[model samples]
Target: MTRCRLCGSEAMASVVDLGATPPCESFLAADRLDQPEPAYPLHLRVCTDCWLAQIPPLITPEETFKEYAYFSSFSTSWVEHARTFVADAVERAELGADAFVVEVASNDGYLLKHVVDRDIRCLGIEPSVNVGAAARDAGVPTLTEFLSPETGAAVRAEHGPANLVVANNVYAHIPDVIGFTQGLRALVADDGWVSIEVQHLLTLIEENQYDTIYHEHFQYYTVASAIRALASGGLTLVDVELLPTHGGSIRLWARPAETAGEPSQAVTDVLAREKAAGLQELSGYTEFSARVAKVRRDLLRFLIEAADRGETVVGYGAPGKGNTLLNHCGIRPDLLAYTVDRNPYKHGRYTPGTRIPILAPEQIAADKPDYVLVLPWNLRAELVEQLAFVHEWGGRLVFPIPELSVVEAASSKEVTA
Candidate 1:
């Protein structure tokens, strides 16, 4: 009965069914494990009319993100990515002190602080009261509220139009994506720009990045779906650039749809690539279902084989993507031993479905497990570097999705069976 959120089309078809996975961001306290944990289907559907791939609501925004566990400042590369984006956006926009900047879903003011350091006026719209307070402490003005059309208008009336509206990896988290995009249009000035970074759907299909599909993430978008979504909300996709982050992500630049501008060649090239990859049709979405199943099977097989050999395996990070992969494969602490995370919020907690014990990253050095399961596989490079010392103990790292393989710290180039 859930119509496509983008186009309101009734011709939505289920493409991939990850049956009843626990909420990805829901980490559990020790005393709460005895209590029952709830789960909802990660059944992915694509609109036949708009070609927008989405998941029907299994959980609400308040349930998923109000008091979130993950923090962007914990990741060094991600902070640097934000710093770089702030610099680039400021340069490209020719922004001065008079220009206002706003970031949606701004976690802990990681990006906006860079704006503030440059003496630019910055504001953050974060739904999580916890992180919003953190941003305020960090010297960035933040409003702890979910962005809606009405909220957008209020922000514009008070602060005036924003010259740069930045949303990084938060577009897919929105359930009412049209309303979210409309918020951008309602706040941005005619000459202003809105840049959104989301994981590209083409990469999700090609590289078996189904771990990125979680309950909080309502939709998966390619340039095709994103352009259509933006256009419908009164915005134009004037440019797009592919980045190596998050398996593969694309940064989309937009102006008011009525504003005069033509899409850059990068946008056209990425669209061409998506079309060549068959993203224009339903077959492309369907082909990914079998790949998801294969990843689940292969990862379980690798963990089982490692256990039989008496080799200890522990996980590296407790990211939301890791939770989906852990639940879908039904992996437990028995197979994975325990997972470690840099974020203190999750240190004493446990992963949602698989009930894997979460520990501090230092525990890995004390235990020196034979293998480390890099749960946030997208951050493989950064994690591998941080935990590189594990190699001194003859330990290797495991990349679970796309295929299960071992990477020896001694020989990072070689993939071990």
Candidate 2:
């Protein structure tokens, strides 16, 4: 029985056992297939004491993130999401040209670029050299280092305190939750607030999003655990707003605990919703493994049946969620001919473990396979618009997670769900 990362308690139990899998971002060149690929347990367990869900320590941050392939600018909607966030935050915080902003794990400067365009002072801390170089080229100042308490103090000493600190999808990636939160406290101005976006645990279980459980994501948090994490770092939660990004996420507003007071009704409402949904109990997590098993079985059967019928099939995106889904079901190139991606970094590379060939998006237009399995089904809205020409040849788009459904030509409105 491994102890929980947050509270160090020995009371933990399995939520879902996803078996051994490779790091989701570990795409391989053609020559590397002959070499043995490393994989680790993808099981998720929850601390009965804290209700935090996380995978055991099988890999280090350097092993998973350095030389990373995921760049944020690939998605059209996500960039606009950042633009909207910047506009709202700038107005809310009353930031001026002299005020400073900092972003932790800011990939490729996708969000910080918007801040710079407004003539606001901003800096990004990204660990990946390749992505950091891209950010610098785009004219956003970036520091190439993993965020720690020491690094945060150094940044404050040189650049002064930040008016706003932005962290998106970063908390779950690191093992040291307390240290990372402390780093946020060290960087932000005493009166300034931190805005964070993380996938809500309620959404993960309710939607059966098992594909998000790759090795890179060490922890899953509910509103309850989030409050605990922030409080440990001398921060206080002020508000919580649920977002539709990354399938489902929550944007948390926080400030220094000593200067902070009562959390808003939105925060109370979310906590009540989570408790009413039974997320505070061990039984809420125990039932998820069965749901994950059903998805694995149903998706495999659909692909096998389609292949047996002689209908050609391919994939739409090579997202981390797609990598987990493909590997968990043991689907190979035969079941899914090849997957296409817009990012040049992933082109000509094979997905880790499954070895499914990846091609550019143009391949879909030339081949026009009978079925184009949308791998990153969460972005089905944008993809459906971009790939509408597929419907001309009677090609149908399909989503395997949550449930297996062959989407109709006119029913793309489910994206709001």
Candidate 3:
């Protein structure tokens, strides 16, 4: 990426080069194991001009989301989070039964179902054919098309401008940040609200959540850069909220530039926090590569030491972030044994580059592995409780990010470093 995807600047600073890995979601069926798998350079860079951290757009969104593997409804906490967000948004936006709501990248109707329950008019724009079908089956009106300016305008023209456009966890997924933001503006009413939830660059760096860097996520954002990105599409940031989802995320409330008025104190506070952290300058990123290396070293050390001790370590969730960590750490089935996921679509498949076999969640209890590596470590609270049954077999749970830690499942207590 010689030029910044958002700013068009030639000065791109290196953040960290994770070597190369396949598209994180490219799970393989048993039949394709003999075929060659492709990998791409997984380097992250920040544009000096805009301070937006991004990766090279090696793989297109169509390649990854056309038949997406992720199902949002799989996580109970996330589902409830969506339900709560819907309730809050309706109340905050003063939405009524006559109000119209739209969700971009609405996965399996996990969120819009709440909108439907309220008897409000709603639509979902999902790219994946399979998941789009699932949303339709769940009675959520959906368009199986990628969100572009044209698609957004067409939806707005047909259904009339939406009262609210909810884009959760998808702001970083698109390579064309400006165009995607324009699509957002095209879908929303001039005075309607746009709520976006994306992983905060500040949290990703501070918490050592380097595993979230993948080809699919073309860019990362701090509130400062996010304000610039929002303006590029005629939307203005009005408020910001800190969220705990995906390790740490920021929920941005925006509106058409004309109606945006002044940003809330929350926005000013977050911007001050980012500036104080030195993210606006290069100082904040100087030590990040070294810290990321420490994370890689720590995780590899734990996995290798456990293998040498004759302890079996399987994985808890086959999430995309897990693939990045596994591939970056050079972990194969030899080190991880296998991983389990609740999503049935992945049960018989293999993780993209690591080639770690993905099994059903029941297999973890069946095999009684000595240690279970919780790859989706961001869900620490929920997974720790769910896997507490491991205590029955005297097993423990392991978390790799934000430093490697071992927990006794019996009491759900941190036991080791």
Every model: Cα RMSD to truth: 1.1, 1.8, 0.7
| Model with the higher lDDT, candidate 1 or 3 | 3
By lDDT: ranked, best first: 3, 2, 1
Kindly list the per-residue Cα lDDT of model 1 for residues 89-193, writing each as its tens digit. 999888997999999999899999999999999899999989889899999899999888888899999999999999888899988888989898888888899
lDDT of 2 by residue, 12-121 (tens): 88888888899999999989989999988888889989888889878888887779899999999999999999999999788998999999999999999999999999
Look at candidate 1 and give me any clashing residue pairs: none
lDDT of each: 0.89, 0.90, 0.94
Superposed model 2: Cα runs more than 4 Å off = 409-417
Clashes of 1: 0
TM-score of each: 0.98, 0.98, 0.99
- Candidate 3 lDDT at 192 equals 98
Off by over 4 Å in 3: none
